[model samples]
Target: MFQGRLVQGYDFVDGDTDPSEVGAPYVNPAYGHGTHVSGIIALVAPEARIMPIRVLDENGEGDFWRIAEAIVWAANHGADVVNISFGYPQQTQLLRDLLDACSDGTTTTGKTFPEIGINRLFFSIAAGNSGDSTFIYPAADADDSNGSLAIGASTRFDRLAQFSTFHNRVKLVAPGENIVSAIPGDRYAFWSGTSMAAPIVSAVAALVKARYPNLNPVEIAERVEQTSVRISYGNPQIRINRVDALCAVTLIPPATCNP
Candidate 1:
């Protein structure tokens, strides 16, 4: 999948393209996207079982219904945490209902919370790379107590990534720029986007889940946020969280965590 039309080589510099515009075959901008996200999860929580679900095509383009269906499938199949790196610009009732139902412990979504041995499945989502305050869906659907976390992207310099989407929905940020992870054909590449950030947070979330299986998903998400390192971006008053895996899983909050 790393082999894209009109694209050659595999490295930090050789990645990224517009598959639709180029009419590329088998290789799109999002070619090998799944592997990159999954690789980060495996890196952080080496023992966690990674379920690679296909809801979008090679270009990261997908319909909301398909995404909604994927969520239900993952939750029912004993997935403790679901990582959603893609989002739409608009909100839809179908997604809201499905996520709400999951949090409410209803079996309406073809899965019941009790069946999975957890109160609710957690979702670590990307806030989009729009680089503005515009609202993004699914992530925007985060206001509810559904264990849904809206994450933004930050750079190595400890500042918000210029391309990361941020607003009231986003509660945390993580290193997303120049991130190196696995791709198809057993290769690696450096990709940048909120897509890269969510998995890091989700990986940590999985660790928290394994350490405290009985904790509610919301509680788990909160712990991650509460123990995060606070970062101020363009606006001094506007601060965002940077997840601290050690703080989230440990009994005591680390010095890096905000009081």
Candidate 2:
């Protein structure tokens, strides 16, 4: 069933291109966060292609400038969706500029539309693990007007995770606590964090994109948001919603399913 359905993927984290290297002690001793993320995307959108671009190191540290460049690379290489499982505590102008450019259908280096006819690319970013409403780069910058989705972590009980950062910028929440996914060495493990949550949104975006190829990033993001299950988790000041894939795929116009 998995044959001929393999999707091309990219990894921006550190270590060798070989996903198995994630199991090596010197490579990704942290246990393959990128690989795990890719696995989730594949599971959610089994027919979509994935491209791995290594940007962050084994310690999950990377330069903002490099990340900006990676976004351009993904766009130029025909990537329909980009999933960012990492976040910075503070915002940076450079990152903001790159993301804004992407939303406007341009590259950071001033390049215009690609040959693929795609204007804007979708991005799903993790809120942060700081457990506060403090702003995190990229995620905090994610605006619905710009076709980006900022994701926070929510528990299976429909409550926000204590470690998840909250803010008005957060667009959606997903099941992230103790979530099980693929690790290196053909293994599966339970992981938790906004990192885990962001990919869920990314995968959902992929599904929406695959089903509705005509929808732009903004429309796709809207479908994901509108079809979500609303949850009033503790913070009255913020509205948190969990993704509902079935509703997104089956619901029609002017009709929504919110549980």
Candidate 3:
């Protein structure tokens, strides 16, 4: 379930590995964040194909360049939706340029939409785990910059994670805490953080795209955001509903009666 392996770039400042040979298999022993996130996405979009692009390594770390390259690769390949659950603490020019390229349909690998179709390439990123109101890199990055979706994590109760970053850049929140999903080597586990929450929304985006391929990424993102089921906290426990997602995809219209 892992994102495959780190192919190049990431190296610990203390390690002896060369940047040229940074790619590493994402097997167990190391924390399997990608595995859990990938499973959540697969669960929501059972019909969609997943491209396991490795950007992180065994140390639970990676190179900004490698991540940027992975984004470009996903766009160039036949990836209908690209889910990036990881991000760096600081923004680099190269990273920003890469994200911009992905959103604007320009990249080293190739353009996403022109080669595919308008709005065909969708970029969904985690809002980051930092507990702050300020926006974080990549997620806070302008939408038109690459026409992407920036997602924050919420509890199963639909309350924003105290640690989840809140900003104008945050479009929506989804289940992230204690989310259950697959691990490396045919295992499963539960993990917390916005990292896990992003894919749920991403998978929903994919479902909408798959069912209605004519809709562009911007259209789909707008639909999901505008249709989110907002539940208030402090009084009672709030939560997200599958029906909310169904409604976002327009499968179930608002105010519909249940049999």
Candidate 3 clashes between residue pairs 3 or more apart in a chain or in different chains:
6-23, 103-146, 157-238, 157-239
Top candidate by lDDT: 2
What lDDT is obtained when candidate 3 is compared to the true structure? 0.65
Per-candidate total of colliding backbone pairs: 0, 18, 4
Give the TM-scores of the predictions, in the order they appear. 0.83, 0.85, 0.75
Model 1, position 119: C-alpha lDDT score: 36
Tens digit of per-residue lDDT, candidate 3, span 39-134: 888888776676666556656677775666656556566566777787766767665555555444565555333432222467778888887766
For each of the candidates, the C-alpha root-mean-square deviation to the true structure, in angstroms, is 7.6, 3.4, 6.6
Considering TM-score, which of the candidate structures 1 and 3 is the better prediction for this target?
1
Model 2 clash number: 18
Whole-structure CA lDDT of model 2: 0.77
Report the number of the highest-TM-score candidate: 2
Per-model CA lDDT versus the true structure = 0.76, 0.77, 0.65
**Could you tell me the lDDT of residue 174 within candidate 1?**
90
Model 1: pairs clashing at backbone N, Cα or C within 3 Å: none
Candidate 1 vs 3: which has more lDDT: 1
Candidate 3 residue 62 C-alpha distance from true site, Å? 1.7
